[model samples]
Structure formats: structure tokens, C-alpha cells
Target: MHLPSRPRVATRPVQLAPRPPQLVGRDETVAELRERLLGSDVRPAVVAVHGLGGVGKTSLTLEYAYRLQQEYDLVWQLPAAEPAVLSAAFARLAALMGLRELGADAADPVDQVHAALAARTDPWLLIFDNVPEAEALLPFLPPVGPGHVLVTSRSGRWPRDQGLELPVLDLVSAARLLLSSSGQDDEVAAADVVSELGALPLALEQAAAYMSETGLALSEYLDLLHHQRAELLAQGQAWGYRERVASTWQFAFERLARTSPQAIALLRLLSCYAHEAIPSHLLLSPLERWAPRELFRADVQRRRAYGRIPGPPARLLRDVHPSVLVMMRALPRDTLRINAALTALRRHSLIGPPVDGAVTVHRLVQAVTLDQLSRRVQRRWREVAAVLVEAVLPDDPGQKARWPRYARLLPHIRTVLGPTSPGMDKTARYLGASGDYRTARSLFQEIAAALAAALGPEEGATLTARHELALWTGEAGDPTAARDQYVALLPVYERVLGPRHPHTLTTRHNLAQWTGRAGDPVAARDQYAALIPIRRWVSGPEHPDTLTTQANLAQWTGQAGDAAAARDQYATLLPVRERVLGAGHPATVTTREQLAHWTARARP
Candidate 1:
């Protein structure tokens, strides 16, 4: 008898990152995301689900992805907590798709992943989980063609058209989550628990876990929740918030502190920033970090030397301002060490996934961490953040090219320095430079008033702010008002900064510019002709300001009905404009066009 050969069965690996168990009350969310992924729109689409941390953003997104698992050929989850982590995830994906050649070196895995994604004929889904900021997620996002991208974040700042906010669950669903495995037959009892936990799924899950682990019933859990809320909430280990949502993560924090003290220390510093996106380079950027340590240790040692000393038996401690400096010099600068700490933090979810090039901590988490710090330590943390942000701030807010960098630090600037802080002047200047004249004008006016009061009339920062306010005020459409301000400011500039000083010259230039803009072309032309000599002498004939003044003079000369003079003036300036600013420079090009137009008009 001939035995039949065994049939061959081909097996292929299917990729799907395991999602959390027991999703409740997110059927609508899952359905909505699914529809978006499978929509008729052929263009690439991104759907971001956002809300407070621990509101089940990740769970909701994961559940949605799982439901549509069969509809796509590929499914991948990437951590968005840091740029490196995101890159690593992409590198892994690239390798999986046999694009390892692009991933092997220190190349950006995103490009390879993008190419692979574009090449795929099948539909796919990529979830950027725990994004810290919208900016951070952009680099890793593949070109939206054949694949659907879903982002889970705590930031509601994602583009409005593509984002869905996840709110806390309703009573019935919240109660159901708690009751699902409680074996508790009473829906009313579960509702009570849900109500006590504020109908938050994360909190409910923690409550359920605590009950299950400790063999407590719903009534018993309710008793603990009321009487020993903090202690009960601290019982379970999890990654998420540390307050409101705190109960669910207290254990994880304690464990993190034990397993990675550096992680806890990093969190302590991070807790000082706004409870939103925090730039990673602010920590790992190789700044002169030990300065903060030296300052801290000196303060601490001084306090130790005199702040508290042994006294009479009745009073064991005495307070004094101890007058000596002690140095710890303990702030770490090693990139590897900092990275290790960040890794530990991510493992514990103390910090969210990175967006752009930074990470974020939940507001509640920040609250909890700050609550744990001594007031003195908290102050030091704030001081450290201030120094770093101030250093990174763009040098000149007047340059449009610097606005993007300035904008990145704006939130941190507001956090480190109050609304009335002198730092806001520069921020406002940058705002104006970026074309937000309305906001710039308002901020400048407010800051100028406050500064004038605080620093008195003659302070430099105050006058500078006032000058900016007036400039933006003009840009926002009141040249006459701006001209008046410049007239008033000129005397002060001359008195304080002296004749020919840059500030004095700037005020003069502004005065003349607005004089013409206010409909006095004749006066402007005469003023510019006079100003051009002074500008040429002070800043050189080839200087930008000198050329600018000459151009203005030429324009107003034409506007004043001297077309022949304007034509001759422009022709004379054309060679200088080309020599100094290049032949194709916009100003040079405009000058040539002006000369040609004037010559054509004068030909008749």
C-alpha cells in the first residue's frame, strides 16, 4: 500500500501589538475611528484620539485597531514619547518589511518606513500611542497614502479636523466595567463604586484590581475608597496619572522610585514645567546642568550651617540664614545616564510618549510629583527650568526666521516667567515678528505699561518694549499714532543713549518711515535725504539701514511728484543695491523695476 504524502500548510506571521483587556463603553469611539480608517476618502487620513492621561485614550485606540485588524494588511503600534523611541519603532518596522538596509546605520528610520508604506498595495494601520505633542508626532508620520494613522495623546491641540476627544465614561458603562468581573450581582452597588471613582475607567479598573487582589467586595471597596482613598488607590501598580487618576498609579510610582531612583529624580525636575509638552533637550541637551546643583548645594549647606542648630533642651532646633556655601555638584550631564533615566520613566509611564523632540507629563502626575517635593526643592527646579529656557530663547524676536524656535519656548517662558516678567517683552517681539501684530500690540502695550510703572520712565527694557508696542501699533494700522510715539521716544533715546547711538538712530528712522506712511511724502522725502547722510556716516554707505533710507527717500521723491529726480535717484542706487544686496535681491529687483517704470513715464 502507498502511503499518501503529507499535505503542506503554509504559515505566515500576522503582526498586532496586544491591546489591553476588557474595553468598556468605547464602542462608539471604536466605530468612529474604524469608519475614518475605512472611509471612502482616498487621501491619507490621520485620526487622533486625545484627552486627559489615563482616560483610556490608548485603550480606545488599541481597541479600535484590533476591531479593524483584519481589514488591514499591517498593524503596528509605535511609542511617541520621544523622537528616538519613535525612530526606533520605525526602524523595527522597516526591518520587518525587509528594509533593514536603511535601518542598519544611524539613518532616520522614518524615511525607510515611509518608502515601505508607500510601496505597499494593501491597507495598513499605524498607531502613534501616547504622543506628547503634535509637533513630535509629525516626523514619524508616514505619508498618508495607503495606510491610516491613529494617534493617542493627552494634548487636545492636534488638528481639529482629525481629532476625537475621549471623555470620562457615563455611570452605566463605568459601573459595568467594575461589575464585569466582580461577580457582584448588584448593579446599584457597582454604580456606587463608579460614582465614588468619578466614572473614570482607569480609576475604575484600578479599583477593581485592588478589590480582586485583596478579595474585597464592592461595598468593602467603597469603604476603602471613602475612608482610605489615597492608601487604597496606592495599592495597585500602573502607569498613568498620580492624582484624581493618582489612585491608579501610586504603586507604580513607588516601584519606579525603588527600581530607578534616577527616573524619580527626573520626574521631580520635569514636574516643574507646564503639565504639557516638555522639550527633551531641555533635560538631555548637555547644558551646564551642575550650575543648578552648585546653587542648590550652596543654599542647602548654608541652611544646614545656620538655619537649624542645636539650642537649649527646650528647643532642639533654631532657625538662621546660615552664611556659608556648600556644593553638591550632583546634577548629571552624561547622555547615557539621562537616557537611561528617560527609559525608566517611559517604562513606568511617568512621562508620556515624545512628540516632536519632547515628552509630556500629565497635569495630575505633575501635581502629585510637586506635592511630594519640598517647597525649597520645587523652587530650585523652577529656577533650573528658567535658566535653560532663557538660554535657548531666540536672541532676536524681530527676525521671522527665528520665530519657530521662539514659539517652541513660548509656553515654557510663560511658565518660568509670569505674565509681567520682563521676559515677555521679547516673547511679544517675536510674536509681532511672526505676523501676529494684534497680539503683539496688545502684549507690548500691557508690558510697556507695567514696565513703565515698575522700572520708572527711563529704564531701557521699558522704553524698548514701548517702542515695540508703538511699531506694532502702527503695523496694526495707525501710522499717525506711531509717528507721535516715535517723536516722543526720540528725545528720550537721544538723552539716554546719546546722538548717533543705534537706538537714537532707530527711533529717527521709525519717525521718518511713519511720517511718509502717514501721507506726508514731501516731508518724508526731505527727512530721508537728511537721515541718509547720518545713516551713511554712522553705519557706512553700504549698510542695510543706509540703503533702506535711500530707497525710502527715492520712493517719497517719486510720490512727491519728482519723477525725474526719483528716476535718477533709483538709477544711481541700482548698482549699489546690486553690489551690496546681490543683483536678484528683492530690493535690487524692485529698484530696477522702479527705474524702468519712471524712465518709461518720463520718455513722453
Candidate 2:
């Protein structure tokens, strides 16, 4: 089709769909997005507004384009679902720039568009609406220059830093959308509607349209939504919006079912989970168990069929079914089939964009899908989810390295393990490691009682848990309580394990360490001096426990204002530490740093 041309190199105003006149509750987001568009930072040339379907990724951007039309010299909007659509839009823009003659002679219109884009010096804006994949648009995108490109997509497949997940509105904003749409100030009904719809934009819009069209009150809308969610979602509105929230995803799920039943199957299992950041690993990959590898591997074949597709012991499985486990496995090579399934789901907006190293499925999407599945199936999937979580939780949550792992799994842990679970102590240890000492102390206190009941007052686990509680109580800030706990515990350890047993000495060491930390360096130095002989006698002079005591004595000697002695002690300890634990080891390095610190202090 030949096109009439305008003046050469002339610019056009921003083009986009008509935004809602009252875009309530997205002011902060719009401001942040605008800054991203205009800010001089290392962000990508193309910024993708991404999230679950109906989360307002497009609406938010469209509203920005409408409000800030005068800021740009040239603007263009395209339905960028297919590369062909982008090419066509480019041709139209080329025609607008009076390059019709050049475009006619050009073998590739896309190339012509790129040439035009390169020559342009004007501040322009390009909005690629409904981009299925950000990667596909790279070829045709204007080379990083005088223009900004905005993309709206359901996929989080774009670069993480370049994508913004436009969230649903807060209560005030959602209520405003509802009240304004219905043309009323019924604040109470608006609150009910927002609560019922879970602050989802599409659901709120549809519900408001229904209320306005049928002359229903907010209470009526809420009741109708509860009684007939599908009915409400299926109803069409006369406004610009054409699809209901449930209907949009219903079609998406139907489409996902066609090519990747695995995607739909995962959604069904995800619906049984807590929803939103429900550990992609829990659904996509298997964990390497430390303690119960055999128990974890008992149903390995069943796991492959349902949870993870298994490989040999040393091999890593990329994709796991939600019924087996769920967590994202960021394997560049694993994307062939399992990633294809995720891409298919992303195309439908069945899941939210991935964020903070995890992918989130919308809570509403999960709730709706669960409603579709049979109760029996839901029960079984729920059990699988619980089992997967329990199996994946680390053996030792007290370790600092395990904190991130613990945080990632805590929500799922809550689902599977309760206060009485044997694993509760592990959870408490994690809480302590995360710096929530009070909660950890309380948990330890509860578990200590439980342990006392289940396995005698002086049993190993019970005594250990009580000992940990004392340390954490000190950390939580009552040294007196910690002192009393150690004072009480020392007698038990001394009587039960003997005074020179490793555990009894450890209790004494802690009591003395607290004495130094609580402002009596002299007493602590004396305590350490006394404890050192016993530690050496009980556990030979070169034993790690004896070395630890010697190291503490040096630190306490310095705290008692004897820097020369401390430096000499650390200089001696450095050699033994290097021999025992390589020079590059963290503890060895720490001893070196301490020696340097004391050396500096001792010097004039």
C-alpha cells in the first residue's frame, strides 16, 4: 500500500490507546517509571512493564504516555506481538517521516526503519504494546540513542533490571477506582469490593462496571462475586475493557494446556501451595539432600514422573513438576522444553514476572485454578508440596550460609512443620541466625519443654536447646538471664559430663566470655587463665579446643589491657592456625588480623 508522505524528518506526537481518565492509586509507580524512562543510568534501552495479566502493565504505561505527550518530539505505539506487526508499524512511521520513496526502493522495510531510527536526533518514545518476548524485539529496536522504548508484556523473560512489575492498587487507590467507576462515594462498599477482588485491577474494573451497569450496591457486588465469581467475570462491559479477569486466564490456561500440559499441571499444583514466590525450585527442580539422601531418593522414579525428571546422582535436573518440588533453576541450557512451558505460560499472563530470584504466580490465578481442579487432586497435590518442602529444608539452619536458604523456605516450612515438629528446633536456629533472637529464644524455650517431656530433662537435645536459648537470650539483651542460664546449666554439664568434658568446658568458656563482654575483663582473664590448663589437660595441648582456649585467653588478656602479651599469644597462635587450618582459611586470616590489631595497639 502506497502512503502519502509528510514533510521530511518531521516529528509526530506520542500515539497510544486512550488511558482511563481517573487512574487511581498508581501515582508513585507512574513517577518511578517516568524516572526510569528519563533517568541517566545504566538501564536497558527498552524497559518492559511486566506482570500477571490484568495487573495493569499496559494501563500504567498508557496513562504515562497520555499524560506526558508533550515531553517527546516523536512517539509511536505498536501491537508488538509478532515481528511482522513491528515491521508494519516501522513502515507506517517511515511513511510518516516522508521516506516513502526510499522505503519503496528499499529491499527490507525493517532495515529502512532502522536507518530512519539511526538518523533521528529528536527525543522520541516507542511503546511496544503486548510484547510476547523482549528478546525478539532487540533486532528492530532503535540502537541506544535519542529515544526510549517502553514494552508491556506478560513475560518476565526480559532482563530483570529492565522490567517493572506493575502491581495492583492499594486499598485507597482501589477504592478510588471502584467509587469513581461506579460514580459514587460509597466508601464502605468500595472497601468490600477491593477486599473481595484482592485489589486486582482487572477484577476491580469488571466488578465496578457490573455495579454501574446493573445498579447493584457494593454489598450486592461482593455477594455476587462470592456466589458467582465466574458469572461476574464472564459478564462483558460496555467500556473499553473487553475481558474479565477470570476469562482472560481461563483462555490462557486452555491455550497453555494445548502445547504444554506440564505448565497447566504445574499451575494446578501451585494453586495448592501458598501462592506468590512459592519457591520455583519446589515446582521445577529437586534439592540435594544432606541427611536423608536415601529417604529422599526412595521414590526417585515416582519423583521423575511427577516432580523432577531425574538424572544420574551427580547430574542436576533442571525442571521439576510442582507436585515434586518448586523453585526456579536458572540453567541457560535447561530452557529447551521446561522453559518453553514457562514461556507458554508467560505468553498467557498466568504467572507474574520473576523478581528477587524467584517467579511468582498471582494469588488470584492460583485461587481460580484451584477452584477448577477436583478436591481429591487438590488434596494429593497439597501433600506433595508439603513433602517437597520438608525434604528440601536444610539440615542445619543455624549456619550463617543457610540463612538465605532458610528465608526462601520459611513460608513453605510453616505449611509443613508446626511447633511440635522435630524440625522446629532447626527453624528456631534459623530465626536466631537471621537476628530474630527473641523469637528464636521463645521457640527454643517451647521446644526445650517439649524435649524435656519427650526425652528426659537432661537428654542431649533438651540440654542443647536450653544452652542455645541462654546464648540467644544474651543476644536478645539480658546478660543477667544468660548468666543465670549458664550458671544453672554449668552444674548439670559438670555433674553429667564431668568438669573437663568438652561440653562442660564450653559452658565455662561461654560464662567467662560473657563476663568479659559484660565489662569485667579482669575476671574474664582470670577465668580464661584457669580454664586454659584444664582444656590443655583434657584435650591435648595441640587439640583444636585447647587452641581455641589459648586464642580466647589472648583476646581476654588484651581486653584486660595487656596488648604486649596478647600480641605474643596471637603471634604464637598464627603458626599453629596456619598449620592446622591453611593460611588462606578464614580463621587463620582472622588470627593474622587480630595480631596486626594488637601490634598496632602495643606500639608507641
Candidate with maximal lDDT:
2
**Runs off by more than 4 Å, candidate 1:** 1-25, 28-248, 288-332, 374-376, 394-403, 418-426, 536-544, 575-587, 601-604
lDDT of 1 at 436: 83
lDDT per residue as tens, model 1, 464-510: 87788779989989999998898889899889999799888888888
**lDDT for every model?**
0.70, 0.71
Q: Give a tens-digit lDDT track for model 2, residues 212-277.
A: 778888887778878887557676462445566666567667777786776776666556665547
Candidate 2: stretches off by over 4 Å: 1-14, 41-44, 101-107, 184-189, 250-261, 280-359, 371-380, 386-604
Evaluated against the true structure, the overall lDDT of model 2 is 0.71
Let me know the TM-score candidate 2 reaches against the reference structure. 0.55
